[model samples]
Target: MRNLLPLRSALAPTTTVAAFAATAAVTAGFVTAFAAPVAVTAAPAVKLVAADAETNVAAVATDGTTIRYEGLSVRIPAAGEGVQAAAQSTSGDLSITVSRSADGSVVVKTDKHEHSVAQAASASTSRANSAKTCTDSAYQLAGWKLPSFTWYYNPAGTPAALSGTASSAITTATNALSTACGQRALGLATTNGGQTTAVPQVGTTGNCIGNDGRNVIGWVAGNGKWLGMTCTYYKTVNGNKTVTGTDTALNTQYKFFTSTANCSGAYDLQSVVLHERGHSLGLNHVDQTAHASAVMTPALSACSVGKRTLGLGDFQGLVAMYGTK
Candidate 1:
């Protein structure tokens, strides 16, 4: 199911996410991995790529009916397909839909309505390679079903754009985020099975009210000092980290487009969303999931960064929570 929740932002200080899960995500953000090479997608098309050597790639895509994951390719629904494929991509796992505006008009802002999408991924081989397991012993409350996310946008920080590629980018980013905080893939990998789409609800417009956001989105003090806050049911990211996420309205330090910070300016929106969504999924940053460069890494390092795909550690965590895939 491809769903999206809008985000609101604020200029506060230090905070964080749930127990160990949040801790791992937060911590992993610090460790950092080699940045991934950016990939781009043109409008009205679907693209595929398998990492380094793994050929028999498992993929997840929005098939309209449901997000189906299968071998090689995920199932795509026959109707209303290709909505936001690149944006909702399940990190080499799945992608969502992005439709052309009525009259084929191009708007700068992201649209609010959403289209259904199928999730496809390499269930067997892809699981271990695509994701990282959640290992922060802190938020160990397993079996959390489709937890909802509260959206926020910074009040002081008005939307940079509401009707163009910027808005399209925002929608694509959030649609990709649907897979954030994914259910543990259980090594073998599995789908949500039924269309158990976790709907997005309105969040506090002015203030981020959850524990998750406070910590993920770091802030600073007026006297050249740094500050942070803890949050639950919140969204956080470093703009320098990815473009999908905005420059921290409160903290310029936390730029979502961190990958774009250097000469290698590519907006790997899928990867960025993958990391940010991880925070949303309640998984904290981690270095021990599989390898250190995983997207779950404490931070986004330079070239050859995070797995750019899910891995075994991530599946283990999902399997631990949900049953077999």
Candidate 2:
């Protein structure tokens, strides 16, 4: 049953961008590999707190481990042999307490101000449902087939110039996608359908597909809510979901930084492209905020360069779609 999955985004918007039939499934996220356990004596009560005006609030343990969520960072101290005192912030309604679980995992509890507890509970449930919806939608291309793709610096009918940074970024993204799935399904080509389609002009739409069967990659201004998008056109031929073509467009409207040092207020180009390429390879967004560390996570955090590499869930999704070597 090969069907077109709806266009998914890196971030959820107030309104839907495109509509399509829904599918049902559950997916998991990256799990940290714990090393051998070590016994230690009870340490002193520790507390640390920090906040960001724009994106997140965070709290740090005495050892410097941190956890942040919902634009707020609550404070948690290093867990001794047992539970410790709760920490609260003066400015916000956030409070956190730390305790050791039966299985030896550290547990942290958070609470809003007494008045907003009900509202906070409702909002938390809503976010959890949204994340579940995303986790359930780890999409894969039909028949487990991998398609060969080529990139165009210049395609017919448009005049977008490819900067050195952009070109390198695309190459890196393609290579990462290819290597991540352990498949040789993508490559670079000099021409498409015998036509020398020089990289089309920036902001040109609808130039990548039609006539040429090759998948095309380039940049465009993603209007409104999209940071990047991939249109993977596939059809059911002879009971197989065969891909016809794919076109990837990066949002030129957002600031893309080539260098990590300059990544403040912008996204990492390779990270964004790597995610878009996942779409081209028949993988859909893993919308769960808990899996935000996954490469296929629907939305990217500002200045986050972590998605350049595949997480456990991202790799598992690719393997499920394509197969392991």
Candidate 3:
């Protein structure tokens, strides 16, 4: 089953504080002949503190050179200079500029724009409502640099008639994701990892859970409700965030259509594999009824073959996370 978990990516903060400058006012009264003219110098620069009491910082780099607070990540590009920060949200992307002052402090500023209360309310409502529904977008595996996957072939537990076709379907799904990412996202390889014990009888488990990071793909009997499952695990590697591995399992108990077209009552092998691959590639279910056409939709009705091809939104999400080749 496709998990409905929220896709939480580190975003740069949207709020900003402008540099404060004090204006000097000169009195209009005529100066006495003996009075010397007063020269006015610019106000002193505003000092930036290393931290603020009210700011909610999410994650900070160990070296203190990078700080992620309120969806914004501020990076000190160079010492004794300035910082660059960026943020992205459904509304749009925001960029923040940080300048060093003469007083050895930093000043942060953002582009001025009107934020309506209606927009904030709408966003809040959408978030609240989406807590239970599937997401409309995809998320990248956190801290992943050059992310890729390797799936081990396992046909021992699979149905004999469908084995070859199933393996081919896995390859097709891998290629689809790679094409969407505009880079190689998954590959085939050999490994000695044992079969996963994560499969739960359909009614026995409410949510899919288990070991990840081996990049293994195989078959197992499932309780009828789910056709396939994928679990991805994450870790930090040498200060870079990355997905350690993903395990994809198909239900051997269910009848699947191995042929390319027109299997009246059976599920499409490629369709299920494609959906599971999306999960392994850091995509959550787009379960909303409005997004039913998306390949990432949580539920797949039997005999539905349309999902074998990527939907527009699904493709956009892939491009959003991984740039074009």
Scored by lDDT, model 3 comes in at: 0.44
- Candidate 3: residue 262 lDDT (0-100): 43
The predicted structure with the larger TM-score, 1 or 3, is: 3
TM-scores vs. true structure, each candidate: 0.30, 0.47, 0.48
- Give a tens-digit lDDT track for model 2, residues 1-325: 1222332222322211121112321111112333654443434332322211211123222322323322222223223321111111111222222333234334443333321111111101122233333233244222323444555543222223335466666667666754432343324222323223533221222112221445566555434334454544444345444455555556566666665555445656677777666655655444333444456545455555555655544555555655544
Q: Candidate 3 — number of clashing residue pairs? A: 12
Off by over 4 Å in 1: 1-146, 149-230, 233-251, 254-273, 288-290, 302-309, 315-325
What is the number of backbone collisions in each predicted candidate, taken in the order shown?
Answer: 121, 21, 12
lDDT minimum window of 10 residues, candidate 3: 116-125
Residue 229, model 1: Cα distance from true site in angstroms: 8.5
- Which candidate achieves the best TM-score against the true structure? 3
